[model samples]
Target: MTTNQPGHTFQVDLRGLVDLLSHHLYSSPRVYLRELMQNAVDAITARRALDPEAPARITIRTGVGGGITVQDSGVGLTEADVHTFLATIGRSSKRTADGDLDLAEARADFIGQFGIGLLACFVVADEILVVSRSAKTPGAPAVEWRGRSDGTYAIRTLPAGTVTEPGTTVTLTPRADGSQWLEPGTVLQLARHFGSLLRYEVAVVDRHGEATRVNDTPPVWERAYRSPLARREALAAYGKATFDFTPLDTIDLDIPLVGLKGVAFVLPTPAHPTKRSGHRVHLKGMLLSDQATELLPDWAFFAACVVDTTGLRPTASREALYADETLAAVRDAIGERIRQWLTGLAASDLALLRRFLDVHHLAVKALARYDDELLALLLPWLPFETTDGTVSLDEFCRSHPVVLVTQTVEEFRQVSSIAAAAGLGVINGGYVYDRELVHRLPQVRPGTTVTDLDPETVTAHLDSVDPGTELAAAPFLARARAVADRLGADVALRSFQPVGVPAMLVDNREARHDRRRAELSAGADDLWAGILNSLSSSAPRAQLILNHLNPLIRRLAELAGTADPQLTETAVEALYGQALLLSRRPLRPSDHALLNRSFLGLLDFATQAAGAPAADNGTKDPR
Candidate 1:
């Protein structure tokens, strides 16, 4: 095992590697400017370490025929440094002790990093030329490195005055298709887009010989304003400019441990609860990403944010954050900041908080479902649809001893008007997050009684008709029961308030499930029919409650006893059909056809009666 033979290094395909970087490693070729800026900023940081008063400046100029020259006043490289860093891939001297690049990367200082950054220029350029004069060795000769995309490089010591300053100038000769990205307008935009927040004097010089400075001031969130109103207006304006919509409010985000600072602008309009929130994020004052979605909690989709952090880690492409414990901690910390914003609203800004709830109550309800503190603070102000009318939960709870809730809007609508007359408190829990939030009502209020509504329970509270009246109506009741049987329902006589309503559809959850199963079984194949049939229940389906107090029903009953049977049958069927339609439930296909047939039959009967002469006995059917 002690052979003294020469070792051979693996040769790399530079073209293939560049293709990989362009297609997979980086999001787009636009990141070439970011890589160059990162190198320049790190070099300046190194120079600052050597001399505290060193100038930290970076300048970019677009040369003739679509070439880009980036010059930085930083600590340049020696000949050996050029050979080691520029000539090798995935190799750098800026690593930490023990050479481990873990989640805690060593990028806080001006030390150089992974050699892949310079190679990213190959994504756009065919060749890269670098001229540098070392700051470490003031008397040493400057070095020039010319690297091409064909896996070849040349480094040499340049004579005096070739590079007069102790810094580096990198020039890129773009490929045929990269000329657009190398133009003066594009170069200036890319420079400002990626380095507008860098902690240095950065500027872009165009072909017109004019220089426009970038990163000239701090971020808007970090600046001081004259008054609170002015600060609010400025933040709103910034949000509108950045996100294209003015924010309803702004929440300051700070995590000292990670050196993360941000402003989360609460979106003004309703935001989808499931859609991800993409927040703008900057790493070490450099624009890292505009759509970093992992920095906030899922429930915080109601915000669009701009953040800058010095401690978070970026991926190799410098496009997104590295998912690690630090990122998790940062996400949790941001969630805590948002929670504080909501709690602050509850304590001091009641009107504004109510407005927020009106627009984003679904988001709050999602948060409240698991957060005990938030549940207590927001439960009183959250609105719900109840028999008493749409009002806050606190208002509904104070008036009703027992709270009745329906799992579907149809179920609530079927009995809402009637329930109100019966002194029942029924709330619609059909909306997203509403049922879960209501089920947790007891956690917020100790004595709150919450139960799912059963239509049968509502039916039981209805007043019972006297035995004499029931007996007198026996003929009509018998006919009505037979008619209801064909429709898969049971008929009953009840007396309720506001007798204008002729009949009500009271459908229980179990009956609804059974009806759905029955409908499926009718269309299913033999095997599926058997399976569905077994799952169905023997419980009765939707009930048809005929209001005995309604004048129309009373007249119909009288006709049922004395008039022709055909007339009574048509009246009973029409009453049940009207009730079913009012429930707002989807009608079965067979039911729809039956309704159509009945209307046609009625039209035929009316036409015959209209054309025929007046009855000799001066009497007509009450249909």
Candidate 2:
């Protein structure tokens, strides 16, 4: 009982193995077609090594009752070969009995390695039947190998004439779950999707006996690069077929050292910078993946690629390319190709460059961040919003050597109208990547300087009032200063060009923070208010600039001697509240209360001047 048998072997749980192959090893049941096609292609290659004149073709036929037959003209199997290769899992037929065949040195150019490729059929089928004849054994008996998904198989020698040719035919009877794939249209579509670029001829024979070839024989990418005209036509067709959009431009790529060749399509519309670049990768003319994103650089989202490479290896599922040294080199080469296209466009075609920038400016901006060549050429063509209108950086720099830029859309909106009225050009750098590019302008162009147009800068641009006018408005200015202090802002009288605007509230970053904190803590207890005040010690002060050129301010200055001092103070508070509202600043409760009281006081003053009895609480008095 304790003695061990020498020939004992571990049994494979076929059900578990099938489940792993179907769900884990392969990405989808659809890949079963690809694996079957790959095995057929390798078998054809083996037959070519034995007989150079043999036809290498794979023909697929779909039956009415959920059955599929794939027949290939290749080196098939004898009775013993069927038991050794077809029966045994993970046993490759490419090797000889003596030793493992040097696959690299073999003339068959085998595309299959793991014996699991044949087993892939079981993922969609309940049973698989194989009828094959050996090319080496002429006039010998053919063999049939029947394998079931339930871990059982049968091998038997067929009649001498059962298979009249040296080839193999694999038939699959689909399970209930996979019956949808038995349709001729579905089979044909999957064939085209997986084997459209395969070297050998592949045809799908439908239930009506009509045979349609699915593969492109030599593949379009291989032939298109032979001529310039062909390349353009092929890329246009490929783009429309693959992505449903015609490409704006096509870039042909070739890197012989790493065995990479492809075409990159420049998308017509703006692509989000975060989206993954879709690249269709093929290995030895067989489709690998339609969404091979790792083949391109991250910033290359504006382009889609269809590439073929013999050097790169696919993963176990054969669904995607492995990221190896070869792939990294190819990625860099493809990036360089895109870079050359942009630089060439900039050098040769201004009209086209402008057109490209109109749609794909964000992509260009991303590239410019790291690429100096693109930055140098693209900077002049890039457009930015200005006081006049949209203008190119080149035009802006020429007209206004010292560029005035606002960092935010809110800030730009507040100042743009005034800047336009003053005949000053202010660049809106609020958009994505605009501020960073503008800030970097000085590094490239030594004389160009970008100044942030904050509230302080706007005040600096305002004209100072003459000394005589300042003296005449001193009494009104003092009253306004008192009102501004109560509102936590400084008061100034500046002569701005907009005579219609009586007042303007200007604030820098720190000043805005201080004002916000003051408003927020106005309702807090004394301890919290004290803490906030201490924290805001370093914060800047906000300024309320009264327009001396406006008639309202001139009248207020004239009333300095005649108007009651309290009336002057009330008028100053109302003007400051109006300034806050005009600047889009959130008014505090106290400011609202002040404005309400000022309205009532002005109403009472008007009633007194008209010599009419003031209605108490809006009730009309009967006299």
Candidate 3:
């Protein structure tokens, strides 16, 4: 069919695109040179693959008035290729859009999949002139395409005198405002940051006709695959280089074919290790993200790793790593890695592992509560009480005569009973409610079962009972009940038989000590306020259980019976204050006030008793 009139093609405003390229695409203008160098590297990599034996060289020449010119002896682009690359938006020559490309399959071969590197030129250059002769055809005519930021472009054959053989030379007339691109220092800086990992040699020609290759292309990624290196060696080298190691405890969680790599030891802790790091993440062998925060769980923020997965889309500038299913797999892999690392450490070295537990106890605890699967794996690393001081779960199970494993509180009570029947101490170190659930041990196991007890409660329970009299603690119990009711606390009186301590303030849950410490260190008032509100409300209520048999309580009781109110009140106030301190709770305002007044009275009494003037000891009137 013949068309009567030609349809108008959609045209982009290159000026606006240039503005976006310079101001929006790059946060720092210094990266303009980096983007150009990366493009040059891509061209070199493609060319070398075609002619492996050929010597590949790139020449960059610049002067104050001449602007910048880059010439590359690579597989030069044809007019058709130029139209497809520059004129088309989505037709990237680097990446394949196949629906099913296995990451494992592709990682062995091709890289640089997304093609948008050329647009970076618009950032600094106001005008671009491309002179290219195709390598595929002999005696092919050299063509030149010129374009400006205004979107106007023209194509014509280059003059015979300046034509080059089988290569491409791009001349960039940079905007006066973009003189930084021509500076040797600026070019070197760009190469160091972005092109340091480039396999090809990148050089710049200074005003004196001298060429300087300013990149270390043989990065660690290119090291011998079979090189034997120790962990400390790698860490030391990374430290000396003044770059972050950001160690990753890498564990491949493939069923049937599992791989575990412990790389966590490589990460260097920053002088001020915040939640951020400068580590780049790679998927498989391809660079996915330089800032891969989501690759790890929040708990693993302390860890820094370059997670290279072969399952992401790298944009043209080789900057953005597009998110996809590969990211999910990465998350799973890292979580499993951390889980296995802790588990293996726990099972192997008990003493060495305890140090890790001590340092990261809060992180461990958080993982235990939220990640039960990981918790089960990490439990072996956790310290537990044993017959011979502190032991790990593995140690406890291995040494104990009767070992019990259960998830619920009732199951814990049953375990306690079994231990008691055999005259052994039951350890309830399982889940969050494991400690609180210990109270049911007596009921489940009857009088024979000695349940696990907190150290504080043990002291109070042991001291509360009198050895001689079984039923003479009535007066003490009555006063404790009155105190509990006044404080609106949960009150209970049970035999401290399981624990050895005389009495303890029991009922408070564990504090978010790590989170609080972090908040305090950060000086985040809003975060602190939120944490304080939650802690005060959710913290377990404490009951003051009096040790009726203890001489201190008995003496106080006898003194209370006396007609002297001042001494009795002072003793009561002191005991209450001691209890509050032990329980880690704030004392009631009236009680605090009473203690203050009684303290003043005691000072006066002591002064009078010592024969000092009583007037000097009296409270000073607020004048």
Candidate 4:
């Protein structure tokens, strides 16, 4: 017997809606001021469309008990407009009487962040009083609308001459807890904070009847400078005030197509790759968000920026840009502007380029990982640690036509000095991006070859000892070889410079990794051991290279067949242990055992030689 109605009015509870806006939609209650300013801007923009000479001004007055009145000489609402846009919570510019709201049309005419116009006021106020006269319609009666936070609103046609001009006046009676937000000090601060760069004139009137103008200063990028240094100093001051740190440098940014202008501050210190703070963005001169991250490309995280745009529109919350085709292009264009600054520095200013790279090289390196053109432009300027001391990649590459690089820090340390003594050029590529960048150099510069260095490669460059010397030290070499077999290593005698190093351990990364897996497999459960053993590789065994040119090896050779044969065993353990220490690789169980046994054996030998009682070999208190 009953027919269900498919369409019905949405029952909006104003109290709950206000709370939702304060807690979720808006970042803070202070943004209520921004919402008001945006509405004023929207109205003024609409009025200017009909009448270009329309007064572009907004005035705010504070009264007793934290009440605020905001008046704007903008297109005001008629009776019907008031009912639809103000009294009816869900109604807005989009809705027409007969058809659905023209979404594009509504958005185009009122582009200044229609953040539930006039409804946001209820967040800080218990009751809102609005009196407006239509600017678009002549001989229209002024309308008065009173809306409260209890979901009640009333509308009435006021007397003909109550509002003399075509504009809107909104008065808010602050709630008990919102008094501080509406105070004179807070009003002034917030008005200037949100409206300082607004194109329209905004004024705040005090209790004593004096009005202070807010929006007196233009944005930093628009300011006139006496000279380049003067401009730099001004921008530097602005950077310090806004970001709380002195920037290393600044890049001026402009996108004339979108009527956007800003400055990017290169941070004085490194920035984390993720979790970056957002840029400050202003729409039509009002601050939309101080945290508009999507406004720039992801690579722009190293720079802090403040931009003002009239060409882009904000989303519903009015906090960030609505992502669309235009926004994507704008971000690309802004990234290009920053890119040009670096190229410009490369072309003209070497000293400045060096300074900037010292702080932001990592950011550039990250970008260069993708862009080949940027890599080519900045390759020479990049720094590298070479055997000839730290130098430019250009200098290192030019001197050593075939560049040699090490993949890890310890490997570079093992061979850097010896390679230098043997007239070999080696570059330390242990740092992040170093190896990849070195590998990529040939792609940019034609004729440069990058070689990967390992212990075996360095060993190939050392001079070989004569066979007769090896024969003379055959017995001692046998002892060394026996000790090396326990650690799955072999022994070699080579004559190289830096003879102070008695022995050196040389192993490539793959061999070291495979050795570690074998060690782990030895100690694992049966199932785990099988799984780990399956992962092992047939890599080259590690080598303990003894320096035949060193005096220590010569003395050991003299005691080849001594009566005390354990002397050779103890000496070989100590030498192998020292070589392991120099390599700086993480020690395995076998390595640890060898180090302990060698240390105790050497201590016992030294004590007996000194004719003193040998120290206890067990874990006992010496005292």
Candidate 5:
């Protein structure tokens, strides 16, 4: 049989709750100081609502025995008020009994939303004592409420004149493990970190009875934007103080619709694209977090930003801002501000633009991928390596309307000298984003055609041999081709400028890979050799171009008719090896063996011409 059970309320394990708050809810035990200061600020704000002339001051004192006292001259609590607000967890007294006050409006004036601000102190302390006399309850005796972390609490009426003025004083007797936080220096540091920009004055009292104001009245960012000159100077000073480096430029950001105002500082040093930019963020004039990365777009890594917003809400721990639609809008607004600053610099200040490009061109290039306007302005200023030297894109285009680009630095290096000698300008597209940018140039700027110049295409622009020269070198070319066939290359006689070069090695991507794979499989066993041979069967063959204008090549062409076959073959191998070395291609074991044999044959020929005795067993004779 089923019976209906009576409904019952769940009782909270107070110790367990305190442990959770201490270990998990709050980010750190040091945040207890921030929680206390927030409560004090909220109390002061409430007091101002009642009497605008009330002193808005918070004082923190570190006691010698083992406790800390935070006193605020704000709206305090009466005996009944303490029982209702302090005794009950999560019950905030920032509202009235009528429940007419809206939570959002209260958030505008008050910092403490959850009444658990006091319970946050339980992370470091075991007992909390509060003595307060409300400003509304004038002439009423002060009340004292004491509470322990173990779910026990008491309240009683204090003697009259206990508090000469309306205010609240909270004293925390720390647990044995948390005694380090009771030091005056630690207390002062924590107070300044969270309350440095608070509107009200905050003071830390040392044991000598001297109080030092720990916060500035108005933050530097808030005061600096009054004038352009002042903003520049203030940003310079702030950048040095915060990042320990001078900023390149300052970008002023103001999105009143989102209640955001701050400056984005352009970093002087180059920032890697993958690095996370740490931005200091504040909520309602109080420091929230120093590492708020999500507040800016990912591409804005080149800037370090500091912002204060009344529009964005912090998570429960207050260590980071909530990621929501409002935050997304704010992030875009901040990014747009930075984008405007960059484009403005590009339009008006060429000298400054050059300086920025010198240090941060990579960052600008990253942005230019998506921003056409920026790309348009930055294109002429960006530099690229050309056959002549490093020159701006505008200069390169002025000389050669049809741009020819090599895809890598090595490829450019291999042909740059020869191309320059031939009066052709080839751009080095090896740097970051250069190749992609070159490819996009046609779409961005009309009437511009960018051609990728590989080894094969480059040869077409070289000088070609006349019919007479080709007929004279035909026999030599046939012999050279027969020798090069063993190396998987074809040989041709071509006349080119820079007649001192004997030969040039030209190959397309497929040909280069084929040659490399053929070299790798030369000594492999049957299985591996067959696999590589199959893969390389479709590889394009390389061309070995002989410079017919060079005297050595012309002599070799004549020697092909009467010289010994071994001597002519050695000369051909030597030319091929020299060309390979000039192209910077790695040599295989077979190529090295051929090179050794050719060198030894040439040495023996020289020895015979000198009328010296032949070395025995191919060893050099000691004369």
Candidate 6:
């Protein structure tokens, strides 16, 4: 058993352990430099704690031989301290005496930890040498520890010229493959990415003696909210910085849900990050999440807020988050905050809110259908039909003669068109218009159907139709019917006499009969489906309800019984198809062709009657 040689000492190389930590634990090799620098910074922080007036800066130096030095005037370590801190891996001050730290349940504080940071050095170095003296024991001899990961380490008293100051100076000799770490650009990039937010200033020194600080630690998001600027200013700023900010979506909550604080920023449309949506969530002045879309429902994705909550479960990597009681409370709080803020925006900034809806109206309308609780807050920003252009739902209800809210966007369009045609200005209730909601709201005027009409077409129709006391009915009905036939559907003639046009399309489904049928089969009812199927089976027909008393209808009926009945029919058909086309209905090609042919023949007949002699071949008018 006497295998040991006399006067011999065993020495171990520590590179293997360092390699495991530096290469295995961290994502990359460059992180080793960051970790060492971070440790130097921490040392200085400790020194400052002991001596508050200590200089708050970290210095770096590099040598062409691939030797890197990190120095700090912070807390240093004695021989015993170094042995404990470096010798025992995975040990940090963040842990309790029992070595139990509830990282998941802890409040959000980014200490930049995980004990393996020191081992990161092996990523670029074959050997590490440190010289340090604890600020608490400035007179104590500084310590030196040297080793590779092979087996054991060598702890010895500092050599004569090893250290002259009370701080840390860690020198790393680069491995052949790791020489690239000494490059100035590589070093600067690492500082910017990981240590940008360090409280103390950090500077990188290059081989040529040049130095650079790559970070501006305090970004604007760290600032508190200021008084909101004018709409134009806010809008312009929002457009310029939308990429760096969260989207501002509004919500209405009856009460606060969690302890979250934030400033509202109305962001620009088409933000860079789709999830740049929602509030920029934070904790302890540090960003927790950018979108925070998960905390709120999909409808709330439009808000750009800075939601700062103290409660969160931030993982060690600082890249992911998890929900706990604290996070839940925060989520609920944010929801309520958004709701309240939206309500305020409606009251104080109604016009701006309306402008937002003009583009995001679809999202709002969808919410209106599903989120009645928020309807009160959203209604003000909704768009309604107006003579000047579309107005806000609030403005529409206030200025227009009639205000109506529907369950779906399509339904709202239909009702508004009817009202507009009757010269009874109308507004869209909110964002949504559900066909099923016809029962909840008052029926649009009897005999006046709210037919679907695109805004552009509506404008054109109003421009072309002469404004009169009563509309002409018979000829208009015949024309409307012909178009409806081409579209493979029937257009019901409105009994109401609107001043703007000779004929107005009516929403048959909005009538009492339609409502009754809808109610009878509320659960997965096939009645409407059946109606569509039936309509599809037959040749398109339009219900030509005769406004017998209207001047236009009377004239057309009188003309029907005369020798020129064919010409009268042709005229009615042309007008009807034109109206249907404006309503966005599809016309059957054959029916359209028939109407076209009839109109051409009538044109020829009219030519003969106008004293423009007929063809000499004696081809009678095709009619």
Q: Model 4: C-alpha RMSD to truth?
A: 4.1
lDDT per residue as tens, model 3, 95-170: 4333322234432334444454556677777787888776655566777888786777788766664566667778
For candidate 6, write residues 1-623 as lDDT tens digits: 77877796545345666556554555567667666766766566556655879876777776646667777776677776766667766665323333322333231233335665666677777677777776666577788777443445577887645566688777787777887886656767666555554567777788888888754444333434455344334444543453464344423222133434444555546333235364455443344445455665455555555444444565543333565776666556665575566567677986766667775655455566555555645755565544325765445444543333343344344345445555654444333353322222223222223332333233333333233412444444455456455443454433343533444443333342343343344443486656644443222223323333346755664555454654555655554544444434345565477557656766677788999976533223243
- State the displacement of the C-alpha of residue 89, model 3, in Å, after optimal TM-score superposition: 5.3
TM-score: model 3 vs. ground truth: 0.66
Candidate 5 minimal-lDDT segment of 10 residues:
614-623
Judge candidate 4 against the unseen true structure and give its global Cα lDDT, from 0 to 1.
Answer: 0.82
lDDT string, candidate 4, 84-172, tens digits: 77866655543445432233543454544443856777778999898999887889999999988898889999988888999889889
TM-score of every prediction relative to native: 0.91, 0.82, 0.66, 0.86, 0.81, 0.58
Total backbone collisions for each predicted model: 0, 0, 24, 0, 0, 37
Any residue pairs clashing in model 4, and if so which?
A: none
Choose 3 or 4, whichever is better by lDDT.
Answer: 4
Q: Which regions in candidate 1 have their CA more than 4 angstroms from the true location?
A: 1-6, 96-106, 110-113, 471-476, 562-571, 612-623
Q: Estimate every model's Cα lDDT from 0 to 1.
A: 0.84, 0.81, 0.52, 0.82, 0.81, 0.53
Q: Write candidate 5's Cα lDDT for 112-152 as tens digits.
A: 66677788888788899999988877798899999997889
Q: In angstroms, how far off is 168's CA in candidate 3?
A: 3.5
Off by over 4 Å in 5: 1-7, 11-27, 92-104, 224-227, 407-414, 430-432, 442-446, 465-507, 511-537, 542-623
Which candidate would rank higher by TM-score, 3 or 6? 3
What's the residue-level lDDT of 487 in candidate 5? 75
Put down candidate 2 lDDT per residue, 1-623, tens digits, no spaces.
69886897889988899899988988788887888788788888887877889999999998746789999998887777787888888887876754323345563356666678888888888999999988867786889889999989998899768678888899999987877776778899999998887889999998889999998756566673767877888878888898888988888888887577878988888888889767888787778999999988987888998887777778878888888998898888889999999889888987878888888887777778888877887887888788768878888887778888988765676677667667667888788888888877877778998888886777778899999999999998898898788777889999887788888877777877776777768879999999888878576577888889899899999998888776677677778777767766566676787777767766766676799875564212121
